[model samples]
Target: MSSTTRAARPVPACPIRPGEPCTLCQVDVTGPQDCGLVWLVMGDDELRAGVHRSRLAAPGRR
Candidate 1:
């Protein structure tokens, strides 16, 4: 008999939720415009949208 194994999915290093602020936002970047995290998040449409929605829902942002 043969058995098959499924590959494990990759997880993000940061603990923040999809709609929450990313690690980049939590830190001080020397070049905010060139933030790698921003690029990474933007690569995923759902995640990027969630982040934007979260930012808009944040307190005092209104």
Candidate 2:
């Protein structure tokens, strides 16, 4: 008998939250494109600013 395995594809980083991988944080979301959180954050300047601040605080800036 022969068996084969396939490697898992790497998840792309969250565009709304820079420098962060898509962790499937939202149960309803399959990816950033359909994520409600991403939509909400992006729609609000304050919330989007917060995400930007977090990315800037990380060790290596994007």
Candidate 3:
């Protein structure tokens, strides 16, 4: 058998969804860095807080 090496692709993390990687779900953006939904959610103080709270309340989450 022959062995070949391939470069590892870096997985970008989701900014709003803690401990989760970006899934590239947005059609207009490449990743979480350029995601409009992430920007909008993060831009609002209340929304950001709500996301944080939800993350904390998730089952099996630390």
Candidate 4:
């Protein structure tokens, strides 16, 4: 089997916690901040609910 590295998925705009940083980019970001396409729609409850229900339900503990 070829050991091929998979392409990284595009990151959502959701910011890291306060004083928290993005592991991929190492950028210091936080909530209520805009990153990109996904984050842009984060304000919409319906969209958020439909798309991020699972993620919202299962958050990793720091």
Q: Model 1: residues >4 Å from true position, as ranges?
A: 1-29
Q: Candidate 2 or 4, higher TM-score?
A: 2
Give each model a TM-score: 0.45, 0.69, 0.70, 0.28
How many clashes in each candidate? 0, 0, 0, 0
- lDDT for each residue of candidate 1 in 43-62, tens digit (9 for 90 to 100): 78898888768767767653
Cα lDDT tens digits for candidate 4, 3-44: 989999654433423233444443444323435544655567
lDDT of 3 by residue, 1-62 (tens): 99999999999978788778899878878998899999999999999998899789867664
Ranking by TM-score: 3, 2, 1, 4
Report the number of the highest-lDDT candidate.
3
lDDT of 1 at 37: 70
Give one digit per residue, the lDDT tens place, for model 2 in 1-62. Answer: 99999999988789676788998899878998898988998899998898888888877878
lDDT of 1: 0.57
Worst 10 residues of 1 by lDDT: 11-20
lDDT of each: 0.57, 0.86, 0.87, 0.48
